[model samples]
Target: MSVKNKVAIAGVGSSRVGKVPDRTGLGLAAEAAKRAVEDAGIGWDEIDGLLTAYSMTEKYFMLGSVMCEYLGVRPKYAASMVVGGATPGVMLNHAAMAIAAGECSTVLIVIGENRKTGQTRDEAVAALTTVGHPNFENPYGPPMPALYGLVAQRHMYEFGTTSEHLASVAVTARYHASLNPEAQMRTPITVDDVLDSKMIAEPLHLLDCCLISDAAGAIIVTSAERARQLTTSPVYLRGISEFHTHEHVSMAGDLTHTGAEVSGRAAYEMAGVVPGDFDMAMLYDCFTIVPLIELEELGFVARGEAGEFFAEGRARLGGQLPVNTHGGMLSHAHAGAAGGLFDIIEASRQLRGECGERQVNGAELAVVHVEGGVLSSHCTLVLSNSR
Candidate 1:
């Protein structure tokens, strides 16, 4: 019998999201790692490999060296990845492949960034330019919010994607966030308020962009056999795919769309599921326009039809396709790459029905969409809670 390699997420864990204090970067990371290991019913010594999407946020170079020491792990293999939001998802795929190939039996993938304590949201914005292809984009003073606004502008022009529609997204997300105590923007928000909020860039308002907050999240991957013993119910990764548009902002393959199309297609093919199969989706909402475009690319709606996709309440609770039940980056905390890591965590939680007020009803199969680096990189994962 030919055995298929099935990687299972034995644990899903997160640190307190938003404006966390009294904790250093290493302290938060170690707590998350310990929680994940405990959630997996395993010991740190059992981990032979560790993969983290850090360095950019770890900003502290010794993160890996210190994290390992704190976790009581002297792994034979340890490497940090720097793939934006796609970092954790991609590193997970890498760890899964490694486990299946006998490279390692157990691996931990963790990500965290203390933007609040380490740097203010404005400070983070100033540093956003550093993530750019310094030579080409930096000289243009292309602020991250403005860069995303540029995409929003083109999306509206080409696809008839409206500012109101984008406002609907932030409004919807905050509505969900109000149900989540952990969400950063729990205060009641409205589409009218979104429309009236301060404009950051044309077509992009303060509500349209996700908040920058200090946060940490982690996920554990192991072989199917080990997963069976670790948890009563495990969320399995059906498929994983990643793509990068271009190294710089000027090379955005297409402003109206994203490289998510390419990666989304790959993962959907691997998972043998189309848009119709997804009960829920936790799409990366770096900007409101991002998920709007993903709805078109992922076949959730017709191309140029995402404007109307959320129209008539389709993307809301008790609608055709409920989304971002634990709030999203917009209403939740946005911790750089860890933002998407929460997307994955929330997808799993929704699948497990563990989410309190924000839980999606009967979500068995879900998609976690994550993108980073100014819409330059994308990652997609199809996860199922089926045992």
Candidate 2:
């Protein structure tokens, strides 16, 4: 039996990002879900599978059930996942499998959060900091920024990567954001601006981190056979893989190397494509150093060379391989864990030539990578315009 089954994304949608204090998390999700269902040209009754991700601010354990009731959907198969940042991409993999297994024909994947409006700054910090091991790590009270700062510090010490290299990632993402009207931070910035930003943690300035906002995104998955009957620009899921190396940052075998190394290899092998085959990459950029580390792990550039890759403008819009055309988490919007779903939506639109100014010319193949829990859990998806 072939490992790569035929599943395609028929439609994708996202709610208005940034601070929208008027809506709850469920409201944001419902808005995006409605758009996705409409875009797919399928009625709500056709959806037989539903998947959702956890929200730190929302105290709902049965989020899948709650979302179903809000959206008026009763799916035969329902699941809620909590894989941190990897939720979106991992959900895509699961939804695809369910469709391929004949368990469902249409699946809806939704994720969002009202982090900015729902939780105070202190509350948000406290909640995210708990991702670390309570007994061994959380007692020290290392915030997410500090944990990633340690990773950045280690990368610089071992590979001679400087703050300028990290700044380049921020600059590139901001440049892309300037083209995207829906992006949170649309103002273009330079490396000097990134360097001048306030320091959040050692080796990580404010710009080095992602923006916080209230946002939600969704996508509809169905069989490739069904997709042909729906949209003319269906984006096929050519390859997908996910893995977790550790639950906490302290448990990671190595701070510099993430699960992207393993997941990227598996996804590429299943897709029968190399890193160079992709026209663009929508990499998860929760922190600036993340993309550099993931680029190296995914074999797009040699270890320690990712610094030079970004410094030389290789990651810019018209560079060798455009990355994060929708500006990514850094400059776009990070609504709790739902940030990863934005990457998938942007990639699907790019494949369909829907990204106007930021579009990569002749883009047929693209890669979407999302990581969860301080770079512990990883998911990679290879999408193509042609089946």
Candidate 3:
């Protein structure tokens, strides 16, 4: 029943991100998938299972099948999940479980989207705002930023977290992105720069918001035993867990406390490790406040202490725990559900020592956490280089 070290990530790949105007979502996915298959040193026919995340800009109903056809891989098991940002993590869990259950082997998980260039700004804003409850929450016409702004406001009021603390998160992300050659916004930014940026919502500025970019990422997962034959350096899935709190932000029990508390605890328990065991973390940074809150919920810091944790440069590279080393959604590309998939890819690369400058030295263990639907659904995954 325990899936600990039962599955391992053999390879990972990503398409050119940020303002990709020429390729459709599926095209990006195919590119990433082909690269993943190649990275794994396996033929396309070896992929017995396929999983994909739904596209916000694309109108395809059976995206999994569509991607299968586009990639020319007839997978025995295929599914397309739509869980917002958490879809990638959820899909990884499914792939591991399916492989463990003997339903399939060599599963390929891919997601892609052209959110930046495929859709108009107004259209994208309109689509995101639809997450609000039609009867109660949608009538006021609150966009996604407004919903997260409420949480940031509440955290500030409850824990005395200041706007400067939130800005520190943005500053750290930009710093990491500056070292990444493929990042969309590589320009370094300071906390002062973040605070001075145009305010999108109260306590949240333009720099605090995650960028809208086109991207695609793919990862290949197989049984641990099979993984060793495929790649000498496979990232093992040490533990994985998911928790659902609510559908809409209004239905959330606590604004500051999220499902990450429950899922993170479960994942650590499953992995037989604690927060200190992790060398790095890739938390969902849809906004600056998200990772700050997640750091507390994931037991990296005590409640009301995450603000100082980031302010002290504890989450930056060469710090105690380098977080979002690939810059995350804040500065890296965030292409719909594919955004979170990048976290998994980054973790695997860090473990493999593939990241050149921004790599965390001797990264043996990592924790990747992602949430969807305004922090409604959460999935926590613990990955390690050693089984």
Most accurate candidate by lDDT: 3
Which structure among the candidates has the greatest TM-score? 3
lDDT of 3 by residue, 1-387 (tens): 678999999989999999888999888888898898899999998999999988877788898998898889999999999888999999999999999999999899999888889999889988978889898899998989999999999999999999999999989998999999989999999999999999998989999999998889999999999999999899999999999989888888999999999999999999999998899999999999999999999999999899899999999999999989989999988988888999999999999999999989999999999999899999999999998
Off by over 4 Å in 1: 1-5, 55-57
Superior candidate under lDDT, 1 versus 3: 3
Question: Clash number for every model?
Answer: 0, 1, 0
Error of 2 at 237 (Å): 0.5
- Candidate 3 Cα outliers beyond 4 Å, as residue runs: none
Residue-level lDDT tens digits of model 1 in 1-387: 111238888887888878788665666677677788888999877998887766444555766665677677888767777777777777877887888888888888777777778876677777876666678878778777888888888887887778889988887788888998888888877778888989988889988888877787787888888887898878888878888877566877678677888988988888878989988888888889888988787779887777676655788878888878778999988877788888888887787778877778788899888877777778888899763
How far does residue 362 in candidate 1 sit from its true spot (Å)? Answer: 1.8
lDDT of 2 by residue, 1-387 (tens): 223648999989999999989988998998899999999999999999999999876788898998888899999999899898899998999888888888898999999898889999889887767877999998998888999999999999999999999999999999999999999899989999999999999999999999989999999999988988999989999899998998888788999988899999999999999999999999999999999999999999999999899889888878998899999999899986689999999999999999899889999999999999889999999999996
Supply the TM-score for candidate 2: 0.98
Clashing pairs in 3: none
Please give the CA lDDT of all the candidate structures: 0.79, 0.91, 0.93
